[model samples]
Target: MPSFWSQKSKCLYFYFSGMMTKHKKCFIVGAALIIITNIFTVCVVKLTQDSQSFCPYGWIGFQNKCYYFSKEEGDWNSSKYNCSTQHADLTIIDNTEEMNFLRRYKCSSDHWIGLKMAKNRTGQWVDGAIFTKSFGMRGSEGCAYLSDDGAATARCYTERKWICRKKIH
Candidate 1:
């Protein structure tokens, strides 16, 4: 009877040991899968971040914005129309670099920018932006200020070369 009990004990021990070995294998596999999945997720995130691209031809890239300079001379309304035709809007002056660039090639005259009179308020800029920087008024110059009004309003019908800016993938 004692011998029989010892034999049973050995069998139980062997069974338990086998079960533990299988569990260990399963745990190792699960841990490896978790590690692999984490690495894959990180790679995907980096790839997405690296996929950004600049705008196409005729669009100038500046400070995360693309600008298009129109060689054609037209009124503020027509200039905006032309820009819209090209899937862009009239250039909205936002900073000194943009202002200098525009002034540098000012089409021999003051061209109309995208700035416009606000429909809701007098002298309010309607371009859905607020100008926090001070680009003092080029008085009576009709141009729509991009991001908001720092540039003053001028006559709408004045013909001058213009710029257009757009955002695209």
Candidate 2:
């Protein structure tokens, strides 16, 4: 009724016991090797899992969101349409940290965002959230893009790169 592991361990002990009569640590060394092998196996699995990220292909992950920076240039409305096809909207800067992240990641070209000029307000995000963040924007009515400093207003028809964002669940 002995288990397979018990039988194998007994054989190992017997084999090493005969080979090394001077050292009495054959059984302990065998058990330690098994433990080390298991530890290495677990580490390999964890390393692979860490490399697999939450973001989809071609998207960059930051915090709980995934961002897609378009290489092709398109007008604000066209970019918005493209994002809609991808089940996402233009990037919406919700906080200073998010804005700074974009600033650091941005290339030389400015990218269209989800903000647009609305009557009697600084600006409005496409998500219907009230304008809370403050920045310098020009023109009474224009679409906003993520400029080098922050959000800047420009004509909606101006061709430019864009950013899309979606939450990671």
Model 1 worst lDDT window (10 residues): 1-10
Cα miss at 84, model 1 (Å)? 1.0
lDDT of 2 by residue, 1-169 (tens): 2122224334332234335234345678779999999999999998878656477799888878889999999999999999988888899887778888888887778999999886665677889886775556655658888878777788899999999998876
Q: Which has the greatest lDDT?
A: 2
The 0-to-1 C-alpha lDDT of every candidate, in the order given, reads: 0.61, 0.80
TM-score of 2: 0.67
Clashing pairs in 2: none
- Candidate 2, residue 62: lDDT: 84
**Tens digit of per-residue lDDT, candidate 1, span 62-168:** 76767776666787788878988887877777679877766664444445566665443334333666644347654544354321333556568767677777765
Model 2 RMSD vs true structure:
6.3
- Model 2, poorest ten-residue lDDT window? 1-10
